[model samples]
Target: MRNPAFGHRADRTLPRYFYVLRNRDGEARLPVYWEPRPASRDPLVREVYRVRVAGRTLEAGNLHVLGDRLRDALGSLLATGQPPRFWLVNGACASPVYREGEAYVALTDGPRLWGKDLAELVGRYAHYLASCNGGRRAPVSVALFSPADLDVHWPELVWTGPGVWIPVFGVDGRLTAFGPRDRTWSVPAGPGAVLELWERVGNDLVACGLLQHPAALWGSEVSDSTRGALLASSEPTGLTLRFVHFHPSGAGRVTLPIRRLEGRVFASCGELSCLHVAPDPGTLREYLSAHLAQAGVVAGLQDVVLEEDGGASLHRLVRAERLPVGLASSHA
Candidate 1:
């Protein structure tokens, strides 16, 4: 269960580079490739020494080499530093640049044995490669998950990086981090609030979940009462809500216009929504009148509002456009 010790090599026979060294009786070295770097400058290298203590390999010494000629320089540094027990050198750094092929291999082999989650393990390795190569951005592959098994497995797979946690949602519409807490966070799932359009409910705040179509709704089942209350508060006037579907290539289109009581306009598409409230009657009237003028000509006035909740109730619109007839659709 112990993590492998990773570092760079210090020996002059190997090119100056980063490596992952192992410890047997002494320091064992494994040279790490310096991904891709600027062609004009030599790749910077680091020497890592590891020792096997108990059952885990522990890092012993790490040294950095600036230039090929700096072999003597690095040697001097290591002489004063801790000596490694064993080492191995890699002539060509394993391409830190991960691709579909590499990701498949890592997912099948690397992560299963390393005790590291695939995404985090790949991300960290990618980062290390990028850093050694002077901040070159590495391509990332999307992690795959099955919808049926998401609920059970997602919690165990949560991975935190520099700032945010990846795959924020667990299955069953619950926040992964709020273990045993049913009512994780409360927000008004009513008017003035942006409800994810794809799902009738409000959830869809997390990045990965937002990417899903028919975005998941937020709020617990109890919020059904709250939704009823907001509807009741709105004016009795009925407005038309139009749902427009567009093609990616801007060719095919379909429009659905429905009537609903209006207070403030709210529209949702996938995991995103927009709410628009006019500041004053004048502003509201001006917007509607303009739309009324262009009513049928060019997909005008997608939604119509009849009553205002004492606040400016402008039109709210959602764009659930589709791909063009010939264009390929995105894999959700």
Candidate 2:
């Protein structure tokens, strides 16, 4: 009888691979090896990469993609130290066999190819890959999804409603947008953990009343004493939205109803008091910087007056500069 684990093959010489599966005991380190075919039958496909593990062989078009897949499989084995029922890989669904191959690579324990799940995975991958390609900046494009879609698809992230795009920041102080949305977003390599942090910050802003629904029309303005009380409390119930202006010099000044903002009054004075609050900038800035360097948000807080109902109303501000091109107009 032929060995079920080994495929009938003619291998000239191929490289083998191994990695230490770290454990408390440090007794076992499984060696993994695969032979790359010289070339693929299909002209477009450069080559075929195969990886055999746990009695299953998997193949992918590119070496890096296969490497990532193997890394994920090894990670799972290390966590439980037991052979999983099926190997898990992104962009795939549960099926008897993965892709069109004789290799019995069963992928029966991965996320279903639901529209929502696929979009999220695509967005994450796109973000990750784009960020990895050096420091070149690119325009951001975000698909608008309804509130219902957000609730169903991304319960962890918050959406304040249509036309209100969440801002994602980068190390260069540039802004981008990513949130719960319909359709797939083709993001590169690994937005991964950073994107998730951005979403959590957005949700916190909404919860703290810094991000309000545009349709609310009436701003959730609060008194100075009330704002102070809210900030002091462990669970702040402040619905008081605030605004800021960003100067060319990268300094942020906030509009405050009170004469002195955080005890520092600015020399330049107007109806819209753009005061540079020292030491402490207030709740919005505090929330934005909650994750420190990982958050990627800038630390400037200038206030602005919003015209509403033929009167000036103070509302929380998110810069249109940060939103994806052509999306800012929707808020108008």
Candidate 3:
């Protein structure tokens, strides 16, 4: 059976594939995979990666020390039983499968004494070694590969949101609205590139454990915090509701006080906010829904709350009698 790691993308164009699984000894064993991209050419330059050795200790607590162990694992043990002066491994034993913003490769069991697996291990470890400075993330260059022949397609890595986007193929592939502003930095626009780029990014994200989808809005922590408060204030506030649209940027919030005036919902959003008048709560829900979606997407919002504000990560507020009528999304 295809590795579940690949999920729906088991048919990607890689020439060879292996999973990063642990053996009975619990040591990290790797499959020797090598097919160098056009980036690294010199054998000495490749020493930064140990394209030869395969035995690695996965439980190294320190990421820096882990880099050292990786170098040793990929380096060659000479016939005289000595670590080499120049290097020994020189293939794609360690290349990354980029997922979300991070990279990961398949693990294997048994012998770590293969030359081919060196490529996969060396390339992946090099990336992990370059980073470890807490939250400061270093960027990486993306070179696209086709099948096993190793043709190079250089694309600008779109380091946005929680992950990276490489438009190896132009258009939306699986990702929508990823039109690179500067075309020169990305591959030429193509009919197939859009979907291809998005599909690859999406698939690899799941495989490498980098992509994250938040809980449904009501199921969110912010919602939980505000839920009880929302119900508690209902009888006290009458029908007037005060809501704060928490900006996603942590920049600030937009507070909107909504009330019914002559059977029409009238609400204002600060100085820049809009005046939304709807016939009923259902119609008002439609207006609020559109604006909320935009707020969540554009402003990078934290939450839509009932009025009271303050939290380590969230807050509370909102008024209805104390709700805005159709409170469909806030509870069970």
Candidate 4:
């Protein structure tokens, strides 16, 4: 009944470098670690406490910030008397992870949980992770999801990590994808708006039912109007845009390439080559401009447009600076 991970200890002895706070059931509710700053001149601060729940480093001189953060992270853990499903820690550096129903989703932006729908929430998390860590090989922070559906759909993509193949499986028996993941991409962020377009024409196929599943119109029951509307939806939308940094140094930039269109949340990722749906053309261009500028790749960017209807064809090319100056003028 008790989670052995927390251990059964009546006497709560503070460890050398880490502090463990247990709940009423004696389960480890919040375990925090820190390093002693002996040589520091400040008398008020003797050690830098590590809060490892958000997958980022937070060196606190005091416990106020640490307590506030831990309180939220430990809220559901205390009630359920279960340890975090997934924890990525490097010594005292750790981040908060929350268990949401069947999905053990991790939030990198902050402690608050956003999105009511499960798929949309996952979509947002995927969007955030890809934008931030798309260009880099080693990810500073990682979020997890239920690999049940992912494995059934994409099995070969699992366990493609670095050289050291230490098996780290998710809640399910096996994980869908885990590794230093990278998207197979042809378009590079250059000086111009590289609009890569794909038109769904000729025996146009429209996906129906749940957004997660990839079911076609052949068997799935759907109205003629719904199928027609989806087919007629103009332009290839950008679901996710990943801006790989030119120089792989310094702190990485976390981009959020998530948009809500027609009452649905659309997320984009360059790594996952195929998807059931995408955003409109206008929105995709808008996202690209912001994506390049934020990643600081606009100076040398060549705006390229590719239409993938009758095969991937180069539509046009324009220098990013030469484009009409409007919302993106400042960045150019």
Task: Please name the candidate that would achieve the greatest lDDT relative to the true structure.
Answer: 4
Candidate 1 per-residue lDDT over residues 178-255, each given as its tens digit: 211111232233342322221222223343443222111222211233234444445423333332233435432222
Off by over 4 Å in 3: 1-127, 131-137, 145-151, 156-189, 196-332
lDDT of 2 by residue, 1-332 (tens): 11234444634233233333443434333334454555657764555556554434656676677768877865654353433222222233212212122121232233322222222433443444345457443332222212111100112222222223332222112222343342111222132322233334345445656555211111011224322322232121222223433334343333232112322211111222111111122433333222111223222222222222232223332222343333322112
Q: Number of clashes in model 2?
A: 20
lDDT (CA) for every model shown? 0.30, 0.31, 0.31, 0.32
The order of the candidates by TM-score, greatest first, is: 4, 1, 2, 3
TM-scores of the candidates in the order shown: 0.21, 0.20, 0.20, 0.26
Worst 10 residues of 4 by lDDT: 193-202
Q: What is the lDDT of residue 331 in candidate 4?
A: 24
Question: Over the stretch 1-332, how does candidate 3's per-residue lDDT look in tens digits?
Answer: 12334434343333122323333334433322323334657543331211123223232333344446645543422223332211212133323232221222322122222122223333343444344345443433333322221123333223222323323221222222221211122233333232233334444454555443111100111112122332233222122223333322322334444443333333333233233334444444444444556545222222343332222111222222223334423321
Q: How well does candidate 1 score on lDDT at residue 330?
A: 20
For model 4, how does the per-residue alpha-carbon lDDT over 1-332 read when each residue is reduced to its tens digit? Answer: 22244343432234223335544334333334545678889976787665544233345776777667566754643444544433432234333345566444454545443433332333455455555566433323233422121111112111111121111222233222221111111222221101120111101112321122111101111223322333333223323333323332322222323343343322322222111122444444444444345446544223312223232111211111122223232221
